[model samples]
Target: MRAYIVPMARSLTVALAQYVPLNGPDEVEVLRSSAAEMCSAAPGLDLIVFPEIHLCGDGDDAPDTNEWLNAAAEPLAGPRQRALCRVAADLGVWLIPGSVPELGDDGRVYNTAIVVDRRGDLVAYYRKVFPWRPHETWAPGHDFTVFDIPGIGRGGLSICYDAWFPESTRSLAWMGAEFVVNVVKTTGSDRAQERILARANAITNQVFMLSVNAAGPVGAGGSLVSDPEGTVIADLPSDEPGLAIVEIDLDDVTRVRQHGTEGLNRMWSQMLPGDPLIDLPVYSGHIDPATWRPRGQS
Candidate 1:
């Protein structure tokens, strides 16, 4: 069984992550320090997940997402990621830092989820393929990304807003990802939308999903770890800061997948009016010759 530890995030109930930093200097310090502390909190687990934008108070003055994206962004190998890497190395666990704005070499910003292994090696970088509204300030990621994690099956990654679109998750499933991580920051409205993604993707792809979200502003605090059958094994307390621990066994996923909808999942066909839903795949027969985005974003 793969034991996963998810943070019970404390985010703003109605404000953005940036505003929560205004939540007192000590509070900001604790939020920024959460990942490193996990090294000691639960060292026995194989993996640990934290919410996106864990660094809340960087003294950024930008009023817009872009401005904040640029200002609060971290330099590669900066203190932030390095701190988490050290924890993974010391504890012999893989760590998924939900994600943060990264200032790339060319100075363009990108929303990135970096995966670090037990030895603390940076294995994969899952850039946000779709940056949501106000995110136009940062560059949209050009391609889908995935990689393997020992004992965790072929894991996948998706950042906030990316969950609303089916293409990325399908692309990962198509590429053989067995487990997917949806790490995000959300408010009340967005949280409901994300839950739909978790439930649907599990049924369609036969893959497990583990979500890490913030509690107050950046997220609704509904961190979850679900199976391929779309059954949530464990979850963090909603509207509060707490931890959710789940043991993910590869065999369990294999067994449930083999049984199909009769196994651990809720029948997706039952998704009715206003249900958080995943739509049937749409295959575009032809591109709009006028202004279709080139298949290769380049």
Candidate 2:
């Protein structure tokens, strides 16, 4: 089946490096406006993925994430999520609200990526596995999740720092994911860094990797879309607020899983001795956002 995603980029365009500190009410309001813009860019969008915590700004200079996100965070069946889900269902497409601060069991929250299908039903949810710095304040996600977007093979889920881990991406691939969507709010990382990830993830798993980052101070807005063979087909400027829509063939996804003609063999599946990380268990609550399991290839 033919496939595509309208990677809606909004707010601090692609000009801000690292992270953009929320300047004022106007800057904070950009989050809500982004959703409206994504809806307008909706015509042929089969799936739309937004940036990580695109709803809330950074900590030091932005609005209170708890207040701002909680205000906007839909309670499983709340308004914000419902409105976006409505857009997906009405458009006969899939919607992935990259990341949000979801309320948890205790006085805690989860950095989560919530998914909705064409029917407006919440299919799967992925909590950020590798919580960023301040993320220590939030709840840790326990498992990796993959969701089928109707005709799409299987789509994987991860948030910002989680992109740093190969297991997070590969787990999705092993679970039958042909497309992996990595939602990021990277403020200080360079385009080169993100490029390495997209290309590596795609090349290793032989799957399409969509790296969508919030353009601002924190995420260093270098959003990218890579093919299964690990070739970067499209890249957005680090400081521009823009939307990138790409049409990708999923069949190519199968080839990348088991590298054939490509020069680069799968990176994560191979291992070596003396690599410090010797059979580490999944960290329960203190997992670092950039820590991947030593067994990405094992």
* Candidate 1 Cα outliers beyond 4 Å, as residue runs: 1-43, 57-62, 263-298
Give the best candidate by TM-score. 1
lDDT of 1 by residue, 1-298 (tens): 4333433421111011111322334433454355446555554566677666655434334466567657767765887777767766766767775677788877888888888887978898877888876535667787877777653456788886787787787677656666678877776666776776788877676667777777764457777767777787766647576676566665554554444465444322233444443333465343222322112111
Tell me the TM-score of each prediction against the true structure. 0.73, 0.72
> Clash totals for all models, in order?
10, 27
lDDT (CA) per prediction: 0.63, 0.63
Alpha-carbon error at 239 in model 2, in Å?
1.1
Worst 10 residues of 1 by lDDT: 10-19
Error of 2 at 228 (Å): 1.3
Write the residue-wise lDDT of candidate 2 on 1-298 in tens digits. 5244423321111111123333344443443355445556655556677777665554445356555554444455555566666766665556676676676656466788988776878898888778866734566788999886554466788776777788788788767777788887766645568768788877767777888887654557778888877677777865666677677766565444334426446544354444444443664344332343222222
Error of 1 at 286 (Å): 9.6
